[model samples]
Target: MTVRVRFAPSPTGMFHVGGARSALQNWIYAKQQGGVFVLRIEDTDAARNKPEWTEGILSALDWIGISRGSYEGPYFQSANAGEHRAAATRLYESGRAYYCDCTREDVQARTGSQYQGYDGYHRDLGLGPGPGHALRFRTPDEGSTVVVDLIRGEPTFENKLIEDFVIARGDGSPVFLLANVVDDMTMGITHVIRAEEHLPNTPKQQLLWDALGVKPPVWAHVPVVVNEKRQKLSKRRDKVALEAYRDEGYLAGAMRNYLMLLGWAPSGDREIVEWSVIEDEFRLEEVNPSPAFFDEKKLRAFNGEYIRALPVSEFIDACQPWLTGTGTIAPPPWQPEEYDADAFAAVAPLAQTRLAVLSEIVPNVDFLFLASPLIDEAAWTKTMKDGSADLLDAAIAAFEALQSWDAESLKSTLEAVGAERGLKLGKTQAPVRVAVTGRTVGLPLFESLEVLGRERTLTRMRAARLRLV
Candidate 1:
């Protein structure tokens, strides 16, 4: 049979990194096997589901370069309400499911413990009592269900310990368990790759699948991504939103590459591999069983690598959005139309080595585009106070005498003036660096000077000398 996998995400807020990783693995698996990859929006909880949240999932996936129209849909779970209801009704008629009149209070009183979840007191009862009762599947009492896991190996769950989970709420609406099972069956999903937190619910889903007479999909429960403290990534407590990364100017390629390393590393000691290489070598069996920590430092490093790899034009374009505050550009924020592309190109190589993210490009190179260099009072006091004004003055005079204003001429003139002042190139460059770029430690001084042009550079140098005296 042909391989088929589906990424069924709930219409919650911005898709979590955990969910994104799951989707990525599923997509890669499907692509590698020449199988179909499906996108299913599980928006069954109407009360909690917002339209914007649904759009957020789609947008996040699209931003990560996962294309739509390649698979069946963006099939919405709400749209399959008829199928869910039909499947639940069939189970009820076949003695696989029964109506439970047991109220939460009733179950709690009999069990004497709220900690163990719902007691199975009403399990054997066929359509027992009350009109506003929920429909629950009859979990088998004997034998254990073995999950032939792709990563964790064979794990067993006793059928008796599995509660008779509710398939449909009293309002006749299908819950997540039933809706998921029916949809996956209908969609012919051959694999179910999801977070390990869902592993506890797999046996319940497997029981429902058997009750409904559908073939159970293969299961692979990847480990949860954790924070530094090793706690699972939480929406409330953790910085788990994917949009936040995009907004902070992380390249999607970089994020994808970093995510790929979370649970599964590439062959040998190599960390940075191309997407095609990842797709070719990615295997469900290779995924780790332990949780992967979300390391911002490592991710930033990878992002820097990806940024450095981009073509100069692409890097310039990528920096645009952050520069101009306009979001319309492709690789939006990479390079704004208002930015001087030639200036950017001149300094791109210098900036590439120093920057860990595309977002850093603007601040590092902002001196070129800003109307004036942003001089830090501390840097101005520290570097410009000690005999640097004389050097600035001499450099300005030398720069004025230069016939050409290119990087070559600027470098030679600045070096000559610094040598006259008994200052080396490094010491000489600092005052000019602060004067031109408004700070120390940025793109190379001469290259930045060339971009700033003869007039702006000389003007800034003059301004700094005046500030010094």
Candidate 2:
């Protein structure tokens, strides 16, 4: 059979990281098998679903490189109301489902429990309606429903434990359980891969599948991604939104790599691998049952590694959005177009090694583009307090006479000038480094000066000398 999968995220809020991972796994599996990956928006809940939230889901998936192929939707469940209602009506007429007039108070009074679940009430008592009736499925009271799961492996839920769930609301709108099963079946989704928290809802869906007489999709419930506290990732308690991470400057490739490693690992100790390799090696069975903790530190490390591995031109292009705010870089406090590309390229190699996030590139390199380097008070006092002024003055005079502005000439001249004043290159470069770049420790002093050019370098050095006076 041609393997097909669908990622159906409800447009209630930002696409959570858990949902992104689920989408990614489905995408990877489909790609590996040369099958189809469908992007379906389950926006049946009109009360909570917003158009912007639905768009956000698509944007997030695209940002992470999970695109729809062959399958043309984002088929909204709201759009498929006709199909869902039709299916529910068919089941209702076929005796697979029946209308129950049991109110909240009636179910509670009958069961002597506050939990609102329709278990024996639907099966023991046949379909009867008085007022405010909702359609409920008649679950099998005997035998167990065995889920032939790809990950969990032959998990069985007692038929008695499976309640007769509501297929449609009293107002004739389909619930999630019914909508999900119907959509999956209509889309020809062969595999249902999702977070483990949805495992409890699987039996109901399976039961619905059997009742509807549609062949059930194979199930693979990957473990839920949790926080350090081992609780499920929550929007309230955790940074579950993927957009927040993108805003904070996480590379898409790094995020994909880190997420792929959450429940599965590649060959050897290397955690960073290409997407093609991940697609080739990725298997639903490899996913562990235990929840994986979302560690920002590890993700940052992986991001840094990916950033450093990019070719210089690609790195420059990647930094462009952060620098210019044109592409994927969302509008924020930092403006990348106001930045200097020559200065960035000169210092790119240095910044690349030290930066964990692309956003860090702006602050660290900000000193280069400013009108004058903002001298840190402590650094100014420490480096220029005593004998540093003579070195700055002598270097300024020597640099003033230099015909060519280049790294080699600048380095040799600075060293020669410093040696004449009985100082080592390191101590000599300290004040000049601070003067040119506003920091004692940064990119190579001469190369940075060369990039800044002769005029600005001399001007900043002269200003530093005047500060001493």
Best by TM-score, which number? Answer: 1
- Model 2: per-residue lDDT, tens digit, 298-346? 8989998988998877877777666776655654343445467777887
| Model 2 CA deviation exceeding 4 Å by range | 68-71, 110-112, 115-119, 122-131, 328-340, 374-405, 408-431, 464-469
- For all predicted structures, in order, the TM-scores are 0.91, 0.87
Off by over 4 Å in 1: 124-131, 328-338, 420-422
* Candidate closest to the true structure, highest lDDT: 1
lDDT (Cα atoms) of all candidates against the true structure:
0.84, 0.83
16-100 per-residue lDDT for model 1 (tens digits): 9888899899999998888989999988777789999988888899888796666669999888899999998898888888888
TM-score of 2: 0.87
lDDT of candidate 2 at residue 342, scale 0 to 100:
72
